[model samples]
Target: MTDDADSGADASATDGSGADADGDRLDVGFVPAEVPGAGLTGAVETSALLVEHLSRRHDLTVYVASQHAADDVDLPAEDRVEYVIHDDLPKLPHPITAKHRALREETDALESHDLVHSYSSVFVPVLADLSTPTISTLNSYVAVCPKGDMRYHGKRTCSGPGPAKCVACVGVTGARRRQGLENEARSAYSSLGKLPLVRDSMARRNGVDAYHALSPHLAEDYAALDFPAERTRVIPHFYDGGFRRDPRTTAGDPVTLLYVGGLREFKGVQVLVRGLAELRSRGVDARLRVAGAGPYGDRIKRLVGELGLADAVAWHGYVDHDDLPDLYAGADAFVYPGLIDEPFGRVLLEALAAGTPVVASDVGSTDYIVGDAGERFESGDERALADAVERLVADYEERAGAIPDQLARFEPETVLAQFDELYRDVATGRLRRESRPSSASSPTPSR
Candidate 1:
């Protein structure tokens, strides 16, 4: 891990204008350890965007704790933004409890910062024990739900986290006998560890000063997790202007249905393949193009073959982040068939910004984020997904026109203002510090 002085110096050098020298400049530290996926995860991108927007005036430092090599992720280096790669930390076992294994050494690294923002729920307890005020961003459901996606054994979405429900769900879904047992044991352990009293005790020990949710649905989840509703704010994720583009006018025949994201069961790529097959069975000319890769690649491909969609499906294999906007712009519509309760679909926002209409499953924050600009169907309902795809393809002109209104809410400036207010409130004591009450600090973990 890089020392604070080195990081501070690097940030100071980047801010050539010396804006960070101001007396009121806030020193903000960001921890993104529990970020999921491999290359350019949503949490990583959000951290980059936050630095880009917040560094103009604040002294910014990002502590990236990940299982993957630090070089794989990139961050903005302008306006006093320094990204510290904490690559020494090992990957946590279960996605949910990963947050609970926060290293004391890492926590001590943030002792000098004025305020720290942790995007990992596992570190909420550790952050609570620090002198620095802290805020946590609920980017996903792992903090509360052990399955992370809130999908019950890969079958369908569930109401919320529960030990019995999670155990039964994992027992049915887990592939191998030993794997199922492990999942059940881990699920029960994580669920019980997150009890109200346990979570409250963690929070009282300098836990989180505030909670930031990407959607109202997530804010509701936070409230259920015992976080103070008044201290929790629903701040949507911001979109980088790099995704903006002109809407495609020359729509193509065998209308291309695009799917961009991890090719996982919960991601529902198989559902998209099934939906496209249904469209073909009805004699409707349609094709599907998937631009991301995952462990489910072979399984998804096998399903496509089983459905006789070999000629209708195109695999683009993990499209680069910069190239996604163009891909969205070229497609007739972006289909997000995710079967789980997605905390927030950043890709849906990217589709809208790129002037492409979205067709997603009616789960999680899709309804809240997409609003009328996109189409939604029941989760895992292939027939309904096919219908939405056919409808959007037919009315491309009308659906594409809603892009502007849909993209307005995620405008970078507007979202940045909300974040700035929260930061200033915390920095200047306008917001209550009760969320991060003082406690006896913990010592750094030995290397």
Candidate 2:
């Protein structure tokens, strides 16, 4: 793929010839290995906005390729939301990357869509196979590196991800090395002059029309990957139900703090645990709640026990998305201390949308997502984290004052408008070459 920022990284898309000839009746479908749920909401939510909008506004039919059984999700379905399932992929124990079922479903589908909106990087090849116009989102580094997190042996710097390095890192970390092998294979396959079917993921990423970035910080990552700066766009994630539905209520006597994501080393859950332990020892009346399961669950549990914080920390493992709203309502503050550079950090958006103030690591896309709405401290500094927590928990007025108004930031209406403008401009052949800090909203969100 091209690397020049002037052309390759800056998307210069005009409404395609197909769109000009026949776009009103185009079948705009969203193809993902799985419909956005579980722990990944950033890419899923953004794709849903496009899917939901195309279904509601344009005369388009949205088909969902679900890897699961014939069962349909209970989430609200529009007349446009259709489902297509496959029999090839098994729906048992191993379920991290739904790419296998995605390939099968796309290859065997009886129908064709006018345009394909892909959430998973693996499905880009399938779109190419079907001769469908596709825009793929680079959700993670699974497309480019061995470890899906792009984090090297618990360190932030993305290291040499070759076989020797990957295997050695996996051996030391004690995490599963087999999946890393598969990822290495996938990355190697893509690097060889880009496959026609699978190459669209990189092709569109380098210069696609109306693209989405979770935050300005994340946009920088995409820019580094050679995504056209003009094509790159920022859209903060929002909950399924628009932000206005949930009424915010204050917490009870015990100040509640929550962490809700993968419990691995990169998530920095251990840092939050250590900080909370220190808070207790320092005479703070606070409680820690964790609601996610991962390979590091046992390790986090062991660490909590070792730190003597078992009683103060409650482990409500693997809370589904449906139950998250109530969890947010019950909590006073949300914390996500990710050790790696988070692409979008949907947890921060969800917490703020629920009116639960948050404290996040000042790394990756946290600052952009926070937008001065909450507190951010250095990534691994437990004392700084503790200090931020205490500041938020100290007085009622202080917490209220500290939480910058986040309602507008996470509102779907607000983000969708920005998307509509970008898409219209792309479709109608308008180009704004300026990349960062656009005049639109100042384009600055903290760090």
Candidate 3:
């Protein structure tokens, strides 16, 4: 892939032909918030995978924002994709203004593609003005919730954004700490999202031609927030064909539970630790392997000591991406105990791919991903989580049997074919936004 922004100027100058000399390949512009790389969030990893898969059959140009003009990133050497780094914009006094200017540059660069598929929520408002057909993947809650995690006051799932409700939520909720000017500037931008003009601008669905939701539950949540239901398609993230392991036949003497994600408050890692204690109280010998790091690490570690679980919990802080497969395979079951409605749990997919049964909270699309391969407890319920883990252990073999069928739904070919069809429909202008009758009532909270 070429990293020069000007190298493809001739190719991008013409209106997308929808089919090149190959007759099947289309010019696709992939817009991700940041350059796709390892050790980043699941969303970026998903974009990287999509780019790899799509480049096999289409002409792909990835547009992203970076601090430097070029990055020394490692992608598959064989893939035919171009990286257009929009780092030429001058920095403004305010970080928010700088970000907006960068978005404009990226959006302008994407205008010549046959179809633009965006993985960035921040690009939604800017992409709305572009005439080219566009699809924005609903990977996060930034478009709907200013706090960006869809949690009301940083504790529970928010209903939907309202001018008054959001303003109060951002003002009163100690969700983010003001540590520096950058953090304060972000807080201010989130605060601005509560205002009527900005909130409405972000919420408008007139510009995006279609929405690709990772799960059915996520599509519903965005629909309630006024995203056009007809324009939304539920396409899940495919497993990257790594982490495949034979299903375990028997549970260990002491069950090993794995949790792989950021150790943030909204992640509900505290609840997982507390649940481990509850399980021990019920005479269940289980050990937790936490394989990620975040600001919540110290607090969760302190809670572990408070609960007298110093020996049972193993902290594998920030496990490398290549090393995660072994950790997933070693565990009997993986647990995701998030407090808020997760947009989609990519970690759950990784666990299932490793032939590990999942024990996740019934928030967001956990049930959709886990299917019959695991058990789910109510979100943030430690006792219930304990119960679910115990139940999975009792019937581990039966649940393990269902892994193949559940994993088949997200096989790369199946998912890539869906995207291929969506791309054709969009590029041909067959997929157009439909008008939805506006409702005055506020949206109900999503579970």
Candidate 4:
């Protein structure tokens, strides 16, 4: 990390305008969905890292909604960053509208900043008309898919969101019912996607100076929904440098395969269990370590018993973040068997950083993120998953050796440099919003 003096000197050199003289340094507003800290979800963790890195070179103010705000005891002590909490925003009737109001109110104070960066999809529309240049990070499917998981009818990956299809999917599937909302309330909230105000706001293609996609596949996904392709930037989430561990010199006796994610059905823990059964059937010696807890725990445990792999599977629900590096280093390979079009698997970065080979489904950007460092199979295919794991076990050393190269692609310094350059370009009017071509064709869905 560069000291303030060095950062200011570098900024002065880049701007070539003596803008690093304290008063002229860029002022940035960072609006993340939740209060960023360690042990939170990957998106929040990414926000925390960005706060630490960006604050070194610019003045940053983090905006947080009341409901999502938390004490900053765990946050870094960055002198150049401040936190502003907006309280008592609308909640009932229309949540998206509430988000817009809250974000707009908070960002109104940041209008004088050089640029505003939002990490929440709910606030994208509100940023559209802001006089300030804005960049939003597309972290999830909330902007297009009402259910936000990007799954059609809770089965296959959604091609893209259409008003009628999204409304029907939310009403019939009632996906938010899992959140403990009643049927009527869930329908009322989700069906808002059909309204012109809501639909048009979400489908708006321009206004923000840039959009950041965590992967190239994600950029393609959003382009299908008419997001401006010229303004979309693909940048992957970087791993925590402190999480690195030495590659395992010896494999576990039974070839331990690790999975660290929620036990939800969409997470495909059942498929991993079934794959473990398939592996046993083929006399491939392996054991599985399942971490994380969710509503699907009962079903997953029952499936393990039914498959007669009770002893071969171990459950360590909700492992702490600090212990994850050691866990990854102990395993021969880490498996991500998600069934949906995951935007990006942050776990893949964790596995690669620890020098563990990844065996993930070919869903979303899993193949792209894992690259040549891991094995991938057709999503939700138990037999194929087993085959991928078998292949990794056959050549674990070679796959593990490739991890360093893949891991370097997402190093904090490398990724932060991209953001720094982009921030400068956008702030200086060097990168302006480009008109998306009318004749552009939507890319085929990867799922």
TM-scores of all predicted structures: 0.82, 0.73, 0.85, 0.86
Better of 2 and 3 by lDDT: 3
Off by over 4 Å in 2: 1-26, 36-54, 63-66, 70-72, 75-78, 87-114, 125-133, 159-210, 242-252, 395-404, 425-447
Task: Residues 179-266, candidate 4: write the lDDT tens digits.
Answer: 3455346455655632544365465658678888999988998888788888888888877765677666456679899999987778
lDDT for residue 184 in candidate 1, whole number 0-100: 46
Candidate 3 per-residue C-alpha lDDT over 370-405 given as tens digits, one digit per residue, 9 for 90 to 100: 999999999889999999999999899999889989
Better model by TM-score, 2 or 4? Answer: 4
Candidate 4 residue pairs that clash: none
State each model's CA lDDT, in order: 0.70, 0.57, 0.76, 0.75
**Sort by TM-score, top down from the best:** 4, 3, 1, 2
lDDT of each residue in 1-447, candidate 1, tens digit only:
232322433454245523344445678887764332233677777766566566765777777665556554444654356666655344444322343344455665687788888875656666666777778787876665555665566665556655576667655665422323444465555554455423343345235677788899878866765667787788998666767776765457868889999876678887888899998888888888899887678878988888888999999997877788888888888999987777798889888877788899998899877877778998788999999987777777777777777777877656766776787776666655554434343644434
Shift in Å, residue 24, candidate 1:
5.8
Clashing pairs in 1: 99-122, 100-122, 128-205, 128-206, 128-207
Question: Looking at candidate 1, what is the lDDT of residue 129?
Answer: 69
- Specify the highest-lDDT model's number: 3
lDDT by residue (tens digit), candidate 2, 283-382: 8877999998876677789889999887889989877666887787578889878778867777777777666777888888777676555677889888
lDDT of 1 at 365: 91
Clashes of each: 5, 3, 0, 0
